[model samples]
Target: MYRDHSVGVVMPAYNEEGFVGDVICDLPEFVDRVYVIDDCSTDGTWDEIREAASRDAAADDEPVAETALLADGGDSALSERATIGDPVGRVIPIRHRENRGAGGAIKTGYLAAVGDDMDVTVTVDADGQMDLEQMPRLIDPIVDGEAEYAKGNRLLYREFRQDMPRFRFLGNSILTFLTKIASGYWKTMDPQNGYTAISGYALANVGVESMYEYYGYCNDLLVKLNAKGMRVADVAIPAIYGDEASSISYPTYIRRVSWMLFKNFCWRLKVKYLVLDFHPLALFYVFGTATAALGVLGGLWSLYVKYANGDPLFVRASLSLLLFLIGSLFLMFAMLFDMQVNEQKEVQIRE
Candidate 1:
């Protein structure tokens, strides 16, 4: 265990038969448990996970510590090592009766990890895109008490920027911006990146069952974390793309997640600024939104009046522009106030 903390890895697999075995076998030896949740794959993914578990149990008596696969440039004999040596950790395979989305699978993993009393839980995708070697970096912040949640940021490096697909990179940027406003984590990016680690304390406190169970789960989780005043860190990680097909449709995904973020933003304002502890930023937001709505409606009414009757529209235009300008300024001030209040909430990692 790193830093005397019990570490666990949760892999959510959905028809990832080609890569699930390799992902499981490559986990670091320090991990105490591995939870593989098969989300009702139509393929042979469950069979592969069962076989991996059988191999692990069969080799319980072997002294494979030194020969086991190391995260630091290990040999490519994964299948052989997996079948003939003790696994890095106990593999607990869980299967869903029907296909729950990625978020649902992760929730199942988190519940199991919490139940096992693990100190830290890291999420690794079953598609083999995330680097298992980077597990330590992801969990270190949580272990060190620097952050309650740490997530990989693929956009930090130039090579990653070039490696990610253009469409995905653009979409990630937009979502990241919205998440910053919604979650109050101004310094964090790559909101859609699923490679992350969370302290068990934070996970348990966040109410796993109430979290979003769809593709926007990551973003929604961030908002909840912020509402609870949990610290978050963004660890730089390289982007690794493989032959795995993406299930997301960019247009639909962006629209749906955008709406989710808007709702989450409102919810955060209500819970954190209004319900939990009163803050003036909430007033700024309410006044700004109301004023902005009135300004837009007034402008539209003025335009209609101008077309319907040959009346002078200068006064109406000036009033509408004044309202719009004032409303925009108030909203800008509210955002600045929010940033100032949350600046200290960010997780500061000491090297």
Candidate 2:
């Protein structure tokens, strides 16, 4: 245990047979449980998980901790034990009957972690891209009561930025800005990064079951956390790019996640601003957006008419420009207010 808190690592595996085994073995001994969920990969991923669990169990100096591999129908009582009669295993391998996407698999592990009453839950993908050594940085803030959730930010350092693929770096940058607006965490970056740690309290309160079950799950979770007034810290960490290929299609992912963020933003405005606290920023956002759209459209049409018929119509053009300026000012002030309201949430836990 680290700092007298039981740590549980949630590993979500797809077709990562080779890398998954190594990841399981490389976990810090301080970790009390590893919930490795296989998302119904057609490969030998399941075998790798069991083999690695058995290997870890055999090599343990202390008695292996009791664990159950939930495989039968995904929820039935431990029907197929990895090792019969020997319930003491650190790695608890759970398999899904069909693919539930990465978020779904993590949700399964999350629920299991909540059920077991783990002190902290850390999510690390089974592709072996995340550095096991940097885990302490992610956990320190949560353990010390500084933040409720700590996420790894690879883009925080210049040297680390060179390691990421150029396309991914640019795409992640765009998503970062969009997510900051949607999640209401203006100071936070790298919304796509998966390496993160959360306290048990956060897990139970973040509405895990209703979390987005797609590539944008991390972004969606941030919005929920912000709405619930949970503290989030971004820890500087390096990215390890390797042989494992990403399954995501960037264009489709960006589009879908963008739409989802918009919906979440609207929901947050109503729930947090109107329904709960009743902040004026919500009005600023709604009216400002409507005013901005009207201004842009009016300005364009006025310009077209002026050019088409040589009609000066100075009054119309000036009025359109004025409306746009006012709208822009409203939006700017609303964002400032939001940032101030959530300034405490984006903690600076640089460890």
Candidates in order have lDDT scores of: 0.81, 0.84
Candidate 2 on 1-351: residue-level lDDT in tens? Answer: 789998999898999978999999999988898888888898999889999999887877766544433332333222231112223367777877668788888777887777667889999999999999999999999999999999988777887777777987888888899899898999888888899999999998989878898889899999999888899999888778789999999888899988999999998888789887999999999888988888899899999999899998688888898889889999999999999899988886553
Q: Indicate the TM-score of model 2.
A: 0.91
- Model 2 poorest ten-residue lDDT run: 77-86
lDDT, model 1:
0.81
Candidate 1: where is the Cα deviation over 4 Å? 56-89, 348-351
lDDT of 2 at 75: 32
RMSD of each: 7.5, 3.3
By TM-score, who's the top model here? 2
